[model samples]
Target: MDAAFIHDNLEIKFLILYIAARVSRPIPVEGMQELTLCDSGIDYFSFSQCLNDLVRTEHLTLSDDGLYAITPKGLRNSEICESSLPMSVRLLTDRNVAAYNQMLLRKEQVRAQVTPRKNGTYTVTLHFSDDVDELLHLELMAATRDLAQGLADRFQKNPEQFYTRLMDTLFPKE
Candidate 1:
């Protein structure tokens, strides 16, 4: 790989702050790791220390669930100094942040739950939605808890495709 556009700790901190401020919601450490490591100049150790420093300084917050979010101070600083970052780096950051935000939106839109029944079977309730409307709601019975969880997990991964398949099965084209 070629050299990174950013080569200093302050810039690395700015890059981190920039990404966090642009994210749609609080993200786990893994998500932050993915966004911050896009540059060759940043190593895991430096990223780790910079992240902890931001938390200690109250520029970012670590939720009880281990999600990271930009605080008011962080956003203000990012807005003021983000232009100091190279245009190419900022563009790449924007592109990456946009893609991650889309995935976060999709995860928010699809949901599933598995519940156990005293009758020894499990029930899976599923919901699928678009940006503004609920497209489908259904309850299914599974023979086992594991099966129920698997069903829910698969649906959550790609609810649109599952719904389309169900519609095709129920009402095939003539």
Candidate 2:
């Protein structure tokens, strides 16, 4: 992945889509939103928009449930674009599971906190402190840059609407 591929983009949607693909699950809005809060502010909407860009490039598919899943092409892209991305982990803990369930009860209120997407679902909203966003932004930029550069080298065309596919892959907003 070339850094330049993502340098032109300031969004973190690609990261979300890739994560979702690895998990092979329909990522809820809140789940994706959580990713942005990890270091910066990569919110669900932005991520979803990036997936949309990927979809435009025929890299992903949008399901009726409003969750974006990886297509065969997306999986291949994941392999080809592997070098430019970062690795994430999946954890399972009984205590954590209990805690997450407890959080779900307050989901509505949590979603309400975000100004723009108050009407949107929390499954797609991410919340974090100020410091986290700053750190995450830099980390995401580095990773995305690599993915973009790698993609540039692999694809015959520059992929004009990469961001849109990224968004579709993340949210399938429509």
Candidate 3:
């Protein structure tokens, strides 16, 4: 309804630092943008300038893959000044970061690969993992590329369900 609680470039930089510090892992520029641009005051141009400034100042690091992460310097400053951001903004950021981090973790845990076979069949390989263990890895044959891709897509969407259903099907109650 109103402009961002962030009033100026200083606040924008602080917000950037706050997000970089809070994220679970290094995030691409698009991810950073999603986290940092919630405020009306933080526009794309200003956000870009502040992000680049953080990199230039070594407050943050930009990887060759275009991911952004907080440096030690950035974290220290964020720890010191994060209290200055509005409580609402901080809470909102926390939620955004948590959701994005969960997505990242899921991406790391669930994986699917589709490969073409010489016989014109496709192989769909699915892997499901958790923090501690590989839950499952299964390979199945598909008649075509589309079928292989569809299976992979569905497996990624809910690997846990797929794994559970497969286990149940393999050993049903008598």
| Highest TM-score model number | 3
The C-alpha local distance difference test score for the whole of candidate 3 amounts to 0.92
Q: Report the C-alpha lDDT of model 2 over 53-157, residue by residue, as the tens digit.
A: 766777666667765566787777666655554443112122333444455433322221212224332221122223233211111111243453443333213
TM-score of each predicted structure versus truth: 0.88, 0.38, 0.93
Candidate with the larger lDDT of 1 and 2: 1
Model 3: per-residue lDDT, tens digit, 1-174? 165788788898998999999888999999999898988988899999999999999999999988998999999999999998888889888999999999999998999999999999999999899899998988999999999999999989888788888899999978
The worst-scoring run of ten residues by lDDT in candidate 3 lies at 1-10
- What range of 10 consecutive residues in model 1 has the weakest lDDT sum? 1-10
Please, what are the lDDT tens digits per residue for candidate 1 over residues 102-131?
Answer: 988887678898988899999999988889
lDDT of 2 at 96: 34
Per-model clash counts, in order, read: 0, 37, 0
- Report model 3's TM-score to 2 decimal places: 0.93
CA lDDT of each prediction against the hidden true structure? 0.90, 0.43, 0.92
Rate residue 102 of model 3 by lDDT: 94
The superposed Cα distance between candidate 2 and the true structure at residue 99, in angstroms, equals 12
> lDDT order of candidates, best first?
3, 1, 2
